[model samples]
Target chain A: MAAARARSEERRAAIVRAALEVIAERGYRGASLGAVAERVGLTQQGLLHYFPTKEALLIAVLEERDQWDTGGGAREGWRLDLLGSLVEYNAMRPGIVQTFSALLGESVTEDHPAREFFTRRYAQVRAEMAAVLRAEYGDRLPGGLTPEQAAPLVAAVMDGLQYQWLLDPDAVDMPAAFRDFLRLLGAR
Target chain B: MAAARARSEERRAAIVRAALEVIAERGYRGASLGAVAERVGLTQQGLLHYFPTKEALLIAVLEERDQWDTGGGAREGWRLDLLGSLVEYNAMRPGIVQTFSALLGESVTEDHPAREFFTRRYAQVRAEMAAVLRAEYGDRLPGGLTPEQAAPLVAAVMDGLQYQWLLDPDAVDMPAAFRDFLRLLGAR
Candidate 1:
């Protein structure tokens, strides 16, 4: 039973990695199940053993990256560490942002898997980010900037910078950008 | 000759409006040239006469919106007004934040028209936003931040907020968020 579970986990990770590579090279629309399966050394049917549909697979890929980025929910105690970790994660998986946003823009339908993924992701990201801000500010962000107010701005900055980074990594000096934005938030 | 020019401009505007509506209703992948032409009471050939391809048409729509939003470059005055104008512009067309991101994500090829559009757009946006920072700080932002240091962060904050707005309009109070961020910049 342990061996079976381990193999399942390994297979899932392999699939997610393959999906990221495919998404990077071909984007969301251009990626195909056949190509992903071939990359993973699995037949389409074999790949389907893990993910039932492409939508399911896309959501899994997102969740997988989220976990991979977070390193298994290990961000419970620190705020600066969390922000720094996420910046690194985003910087590393830049293409995922494009795939994620494109899928989200199309996922307006309630039934689309990415809709729920994004909704949940936003909630989690926002909540955690807000928690970090509160920790740093300790009840004073000044200029009437509450944890509630600042959290979404933080998310927006990350999302918006991802757009900038998508076109030209050189366009924005990302780490410097993040640090400055953070400083602005902390200013009294 | 003047009448012909006026008619052509009107037709172009109509086509762009129709395209926006079509893309809004149908996902980008599902929005076709025929659907857009049909929406605007024109034949596909007529649409093609104005925009030779879907990509060309999409980029035109983005540029038109950009031009309309910026008041045709009338915000070329001082820095604060320019930044304030940007805040107001984003407040009005919050949806375009995601719409433009979605479009760019789908059209990532180096040859795609958005490649150039965003490249130039970033240059202009960066310069204007940097100018705003320079106006307030001159060289130093409170808390040891510099305009050269702060410009990219301001740009990132603007970009970041737009993405959050797409998922949840209420997530960030657009004008208020910008106001606070700007205040923080001025404080620096």
Candidate 2:
């Protein structure tokens, strides 16, 4: 039974990979399940074996993205780690970044799978990073700036930098810009 | 003849405004020309008289957005005026910001009309903003940064910040973040 479950998990992961590829190539509405299945050498029914609905699959894709972005590779405090990961991420899969941005745009509907996924994801990341801020700079919260305030800027700058990179990757020294952000926060 | 021309322009503007509204509520594919026509109280063909293709219409919408965002208000330097305009824009119609972010996510192809539009827009903004940077600092670039680097970062930061704002408007203090960016740039 364990072997069967492991196999199922692998299949789901494979399907999810294919979905990302398709979504990246074609925007959300542009990519269909059949195309995704074709990319994965599976039938539509087989794809459904993992994600019973499109919404479920959208959630999976977002969850997968969150994992891939962070990837359990936090070597230090959440801020630097997150920024470092973003720099690495932009270099690794520019396509995924575009896909992410596109998903965000399309996922604004209140009940869209991505809406809930992103809301939850941000809540968690904000809290986690905020905790790290507390641990490191609990007494000095940037002129008593709450973690709530700092968390959003950290996430926002990372996202904003990616958009800038997409337009002209060579021009933007993302890490340096991030350091500048830190300096400004410290100044405040 | 001028009367007719003025009326025609109004129709076009009306259509573009309607398009922005619908596209904001619904994704691009969801916002059909028919729906835009309906919103503007024009027949589909009447709308097409101004924009023969959906792509043309979208481009018009983007141009309208550019005007509205910048206010085409005749500023001495676009960079300074526009940075301040971000606040006005967020307040003007939150939907436009959302749609712009949505479009960025959808910008997977460098060749898509929207992509081309964004590229041109970015280039124009970069050049103008870079000129602002040059004027703010001496002829010598700051931090070994060229106009090329500064231009891209400026665009990227704004784009990135928009995504964050769309996700949670309260996530980042837009103006304060811009100030942080400037301090980092030492542009202030």
Candidate 3:
């Protein structure tokens, strides 16, 4: 029984990885379970046994991406420099970044399936950024604003850089621009 | 003859407005010329006479949006306060903003029709932002960086805020956040 469960978990992980590839290549609206299942050498029915629905599959893909980004480690304790490193890491994987950017853009609509997920995630991200700032520079940052006030602005810079970089990779150096932002934060 | 030209120009403007509505409602991939024509009380063939193609319609919509944001005037001469007002104005029109954001996101893909348009637009926007900063602050801005170096970052903040605000309007006060960014520019 233990061996069977391990095998099932491994297969599920494979499906999620394949789903990310499809999403990157075809975008969320274009990505289909049939394509993802084909990529993983599974029949559509077999994939459904794990994800149940397309929405379930998308949620898994998004959750899995977060895990890769945070290293499945303690994100709460990370400081600004660690966040900079995360930006550099994202540049190395354009496919993953493209999938994320596309979904993020689509989720803004009133009725997108991933709308609540992104909204809640961003709130959590901003709160965590505020905590990171407070830990590094106390309640107030360099600009005389409280950490809470600076947090969303920080989040915006990170996401904004991703959009610009994805649109014009050669013109916008994602990692370098992020480093410049770090200088703005007075962290460098 | 002049009256005929004026009437044709009015029809073109109406079609662009209807196209923005279709894009906001159905997204770029889902939006169709037929739907836009229906909204504007024309057949698709009549709409095509004005736009030539759906891509042309999209370009017209984007250009019109720019005209609204900048008053069809010199963006390089605008100050931070004016940019803040544009953000406030955008907040009042969520559908138009949504259409722009959705298209911006999709344009990042490898073969998206709007890819070249967005890439070129950002290049122009960043240059204009740099000029705006330089005109307001001379050689350097608050953060001790040249306007040229800081332009992309400024553009990123504006676009980034739109994504976050669209996802969660209650949590994100978009105009207030933009004002904070203006403060970063030392405009206040």
Candidate 4:
């Protein structure tokens, strides 16, 4: 029974990875369940047994991406300085960034399935960023704004830079630009 | 002859508008030419008389958006302070922004028709931004980076803030966040 459960878990992981690849190649709207199933060598019926719905598969892909980024919740302790390193790390993985950016871009349309996920995620991200800023600058940053006020911009730069870099990696050095932003944030 | 040409131009403009609405509702990948044609009261073959291909229609939609933003090439003299105003202007037009963001997000995938369009557009935008920075700050910004080095970040912040604002308009004030970014740029 234990071995059977482990095998099922392994199959689920493989399916999620395949879903990411399909979503990366085609935006989530363009990625079909059949394509993902084929990549993982599962029939559409078999894939449905695991994900239940395309939306469920998409959520799993997104959650799996976050897990990879946070190393299973290590994001709870991220410092402001570490963001630059994170950007640098992201530059090494274009496929994941492409998938995330595609989903984010597509989710803004009316009634998109991922809309709620990104909306809630940004709010939580803003709150976490505010905490990071507050921890570093003590209420107000050097520019005389509170951490809560500045957090969204910080998040915006990170996300925005990814879009630009993904479009043209050679021209836009993601890590260097992020460090430059950190300098701007630190300026008095 | 003059009346016939004028009518053709009007019909083409109507087709582009319908394409924008459809692309805004469904991403470029998910948006079908037939749907756009139907919205504009044309058969798909009739739509072909104007656009010839889906890619041509997509480009027309993109160019139309640029024309709207630049007011027919008045982007030539935009000052740094005007960027904040521009952000405010963008907030007034959610559908246009959503359409552009959706295309941009989907364009990053391999073989996307808009990929080359966006890639070239960013390079041009970066150069334009660099010129804007140089005009405002001379050889270097207050933060000591050259205009060329700083241009990408400025563009990133604007594009990035838009994504965040689109996801949760109430949580993020695009205009306010942009002004804060300007302040950060001007900080000594």
Candidate 5:
């Protein structure tokens, strides 16, 4: 029974992987369960049995991707230099980054399934950034803005660099630009 | 004959307006010509007279929005303060900004119809930003980076702030955040 359950988990992981690939090629609106099923040599019914719904599968894919990036949880008091490393790491994985960016852009619409997820995620991220800033710089940053004020700028640069780098990789060096932002914050 | 031509032009503008509404609500992939035509009280066949294809209509809507933002022409040597004004102005029109953001996000997908438009647009925008930075700061800015090095960061902040603002408007003061970025650049 344990072996059977393990097999099921493996199948579920494969479905999420295929879904990411499909979403990378087609935007979330264009990605369909049948394409994901076919990619994994499973029927639509088989995919549904594991995910129950397309939205569920999308959530799983998002969670899985985040796990890969965050190591299954948020890092408390993550420093600016660590974020610079993550940005550099992201540059090596264009497909995953593209999929994540596309979903992020789509989530801004009123009814997108991922809307709440991204909205909540940013709130948490801003908080985490604030903690990091406070840990490093105390009450106020070198720019005279409080940690709360600087948090959004940190989040914005991370996301904004992804958009520009994805659009033109050669032109926008994501990590270097991020380091520049760090310098602006007076971080060493 | 002049009156007939003017009426035709009005019809084209109406179609573009309807298209923006549909795209904003349903995203580009989910939107259909039928829905846009229905919104403007025109049959799909009639709409085709104004825009031969959906892609053409999409392009028209984007161009129209650009016209509105650019004031029907590009600014020559636009200053940093002017960009701050543009960001502030964008906050006032949520619908237009949402549609543009949705399309910009979707354009990252390889075969998306807006891909080429965005790619070319960014190339132009980055050059314009470099020009603006050079005009304002000359060869080396206070941050010790060249205008060319700084242009992408400027573009990134403008777009990055949009994503953060779109996600959580109450938490992010988009214009003020932009002002913070300008301060980082040491722009007066």
Candidate 6:
């Protein structure tokens, strides 16, 4: 039973990785289940046995990315400096960033499946960022804005920098620019 | 001859508007030329007479957006204050923003048609942003970085804030966040 379960888990992981590549190459709206299934050498029905639906597969892909970023929910103790480190880390992984950005860009349409996921995620991210800011700068940052007010900007900079860097890597150094932003935030 | 020219221009403008609506509803990759043609009351062959190709139509839509934002090349005098106003202006036009963002997101995918347009546009935008910073801050911003160094971050903040705002309008006040960013830039 243990060995059988291990094989199933491995297969599921493979499918998720394949889905990421397809989504990266084509935006989520452009990626099809058959394409993902073909990449992993499975029939469409075989892939469906694991993900059940394309939306389910997309959610799995997103969850897998978060796991990679947070090291399995290790973000509980993330600080502002740690966030800088995360930006640096992201620079090395263009494929993952491309997929995330593509999905994020597509999700703003009227009724995208990922719309709810990104909305909830951004809300939680803003709250977490506010916590990080408060822990680092007390209630008010140096510019006289509260942590809650500053959190969304922090999140925006990270996300926005990714799009620019992905489009023009040589011109926009994501990590260096992010450090510059941190300086702006820390300015007295 | 003058009347014919005016009618031609009007028809082209109508096609661009329909293309924008279609692209916003479905991402560039998911959007079909036939759908855009139908929306504009043209057969696909008739739409081809104006745009020639889907890529051409996409560029026209993008150019139209720039015209709206710049008031037909009046961006030469844009300062940081003016940029903040642009953000406020953008909030009122969610359809245009959604179309631009969708194309931008999809353009990052490999071999996407709009990739070249976005790449060149960012380079131009970054240079323009540098000029704006230099005009305001001379050699160095208050934070001590040169205008050239700070330019990408400014652009990133505006683009990034838009994504956050589009995803959750209730959570992110785009104009207010942009003002806070401007304050951060002017901080000593």
Q: Using lDDT as the measure, which candidate wins?
A: 6
Ranking by DockQ: 4, 6, 3, 5, 1, 2
- Which regions of candidate 6 deviate over 4 angstroms? A1-11, A17-41, A52-55, B1-10, B17-41, B53-55
- Evaluated at residue B110, the lDDT of candidate 2 is 50
Candidate 1 stretches greater than 4 Å from native: A1-10, A21-31, A52-55, A101-112, A142-144, B1-10, B20-32, B78-95, B107-112
Off by over 4 Å in 5: A1-11, A17-32, A38-41, A53-55, B1-11, B17-32, B35-41, B53-55
Model 1 scores a TM of 0.82
Model 3, position A164: C-alpha lDDT score? 86
**Sort order, lDDT high to low:** 6, 4, 3, 5, 1, 2
Residue-wise C-alpha lDDT for candidate 2, range A42-156, written one tens digit per residue: 9889888888777677678867876766665532345544565466656566666666665665665345567766666665776766676666667456544555556655666
Worst 10 residues of 2 chain B by lDDT: B73-82
lDDT of 5 by residue, B124-149 (tens): 88888888888888997776677877
> lDDT of each structure?
0.71, 0.66, 0.82, 0.83, 0.80, 0.84
Per residue, candidate 6 scores C-alpha lDDT tens digits across A1-188 of 99999999999999999988887676555568999999999999999999887877877898898888777774556778988999998898787788788888878877888888888888888888888888899999987788988888888889988888988899889999999888888888
TM-score of each: 0.82, 0.76, 0.88, 0.86, 0.85, 0.86
TM-score of chain B of each: 0.75, 0.77, 0.85, 0.83, 0.82, 0.83
Off-target runs (Cα >4 Å) in candidate 4 are A1-11, A17-41, A53-55, B1-10, B17-41, B52-55, B74-76
Error of 4 at A107 (Å): 0.9
Cα lDDT of model 4 by residue, A157-184, tens digit: 8888888898899999989998988877
Off by over 4 Å in 3: A1-7, A20-32, A52-56, B1-7, B20-35, B52-56
**DockQ computed for model 1 against the true two-chain complex using alpha carbons:** 0.37
Candidate 1 C-alpha lDDT tens digits along B37-127: 9999999998999999887887887887777766787333456645666676667754455566566555543345667777677767777
| Deviation from native of the Cα of residue A27 in model 1, angstroms | 6.2
